[model samples]
Target: MGQGQQEKVATSLAGTVGEEISASLAPVDAELAARYPGDPGTRQPVHTVYVPGDLLTADTVRSWGDQALAALDEHAPDAASLAAVLGLSDDLAGPVHDRVRAKLRQEPVEDLRVDFEDGYGHRADAEEDHAAARAARLVARAYADGTAPPYTGIRMKCMEAAVRDRGIRTLDVFLTGLMEAGGLPGGLVLTLPKVTYPEQVTAMVRLLDAFERAHGLAPGRIGFEIQIETSQAILAADGTATVARMIQAAEGRATGLHYGTFDYSACLGVSAAHQASDHPAADHAKAVMQVAAAGTGVRVSDGSTNVLPVGPTAQVHAAWRLHYGLTRRALARAYYQGWDMHPGHLPTRYAAVFAFYREGLAAAAARLARYAERATGDVMDEPATAKALSGYLLRGLDCGALDLAEVTGLTGLDRAGLEAFATPRRGDLTASAG
Candidate 1:
């Protein structure tokens, strides 16, 4: 085997073979690009607080924060007390406790939904209409006055025949009120609850389309969450993933798939005592939602627990432990967001979130730094892993779990660098990797 005479190897395929294959699969490629566009690289809130429509005043956000602080003052009193109640490790106790209080004083609710469905219950048409319009006015003013959460909107009733017209009227009044009060806030979010069929999602799309037209807003300017309350939303009669179809039917306006814990559990006939976010039934539903939403620019949010941290200190401690444990478990399972039904849930919510991110920050930073430098270690990583690592750190930063200086110091990557790693196109991720 002389070097100059290496078997005279030559290509067997024609030069146009690659081009022919690519041309043949062009439509498939386009479909893939359109359907699986990956995450939108926006800031996803860690939790959404649901308040009844009638209770959502302009000061509701601040009121919740104050109430959370009061709860902390009366029950926990200090970081050590909270740490004891929540069973936090010594390493995490001080920082997590302090951060929770600070967060309560500063930005308590990351996202808020004025609930017109289950939380608000059935009301007269006039009363519901007034509440909807009032919610919009107050929310708009909150935004203008710089007191609103990062995201705020309403959760309208389901598209079920019984409440379809009422839900439509509420949504119309809300959006119209926001428009009349100047304009819809950029943080506006809408939730269509108890969705069981893809056609229901299509109907929501049509409704929003009409709203945009009436207001002269751009097409696709509005997006809403599809709440998975019914078991049929997860599995259709035809044995298909109805939730996935719902996302498609949304025509690119679906921003999230929110689990409704109690309703979903009820739909499956789970016992009231066993209906929880971590229940086996809930896990199956959220798992389906997660898979359906992955790479489709749609987020999945876990449902809230009914347990409120109130009453005696012992009872409050028990409830806090439950909420914190559920939240931590959800984070481990990659469900980054959930619902907070009570102001008392805020402290434990932030505590669990802060602890989760802070506990893993150093390891994530080291791994990302190694990847950035193309260095080898015990664990092997690829572009997708890098994306995940960067995304984790970014979420931490977005939710105030980690500071910019600390993250940059540990990873040696600025915010821009992290964003670059986190948001590249799927194909480009591997294609551009060295």
Candidate 2:
């Protein structure tokens, strides 16, 4: 009897809608606009070269800390320290170059990746090393205390089993403790070193999944970004497919994919010595990743420019960059994002980003127009049956060719019209996860 009366009340409420209905409807359209906003006409090209100052010393780190804390006092918030600029050869000649290294770590960079290669020094444990433990504590303290640089994450050893095992084990302890202690200051993303296959990513995902579950944290709270540093990742048939499989495996959990230009070049034996990130081969790798992840929502970032141009003067470095063709080549690549090793590279990063969006918007507008024409035809053919039209419209939306309102305007139905495309008449959308 109570159930019957409750049903009657619901029915009456549905039928008696008046001012309340109008009031609620007004907000729905407003909310829709809030959500979509007509795409901002075009998105700003991602110009972030997430610099990772991986090799900064305790004193250099301290200097940056002092600068950041001081900036917090005055007006403009200054940038974080630059990536530690260590000469690869270090075969030293006249006069020591400590001044350059000191200055590099003084300027604040967005994201700094500490390199673990030669000169970084290693742990005796091999497994639970001092370096790994030290990095964790540094990250926890920096981020936890709100003293972290603008944003930070580490590119640990890549794909080798030893590297992977060490990274996973070390990260497992470090991150677990951080999460227990209310998590790192902001967020953390581990960059897999020499990623050759999808299984490596899948393994990391599983470990992260287990770690989150064990810590009583939200499952998949931790995200990972894979580095396409090996030749395997560029193979359309093999390596690329492996990457796609990994993405599929970590469907909701993957953050982004980055091209490790130098490492990838190394895999191909492009240079007997060190393969530079700005090398032509690296450009090819960046383009390949861009093409592979085109439709996917995954963010793509290019590797850093390997060369560290000398001096503090902007003109000196600007001339060097233009002469080397490093900035333009990486900027021209399909990937909108790249890595910044030196804080001095900010100008180039900003320039390339703005240029990319300026060029992309017009092409996007044209493509969207074509998709809309096809969608209008589909809707007209079967006005009542929205499946054909809805699918096309949704596809267009995914491609950023059609905005929700524009698609709905043409179809003469709201976003709800896409329900049929997602779920058949007898098919309820919320039935089960599968």
User: Which candidate has the top score in lDDT?
Assistant: 1
Best by TM-score: 1
Q: What is the per-residue lDDT of model 1 for residues 77-145, given as tens digits with 9 covering 90 to 100?
A: 987888888888898888898888889989999999999998899999999999999998889889898
Q: Per-model C-alpha lDDT, please? A: 0.93, 0.50
Per-model TM against the reference: 0.96, 0.56
lDDT of 2 by residue, 200-304 (tens): 777777887888788677776777677787677767454345566655566456666787766677678887455776667876776666655543446677666
TM accuracy, model 1? 0.96
Q: Once superposed on the true structure, which residue ranges of model 2 sit more than 4 Å away at CA?
A: 1-107, 114-121, 126-128, 236-240, 272-280, 311-315, 318-320, 323-325, 351-434
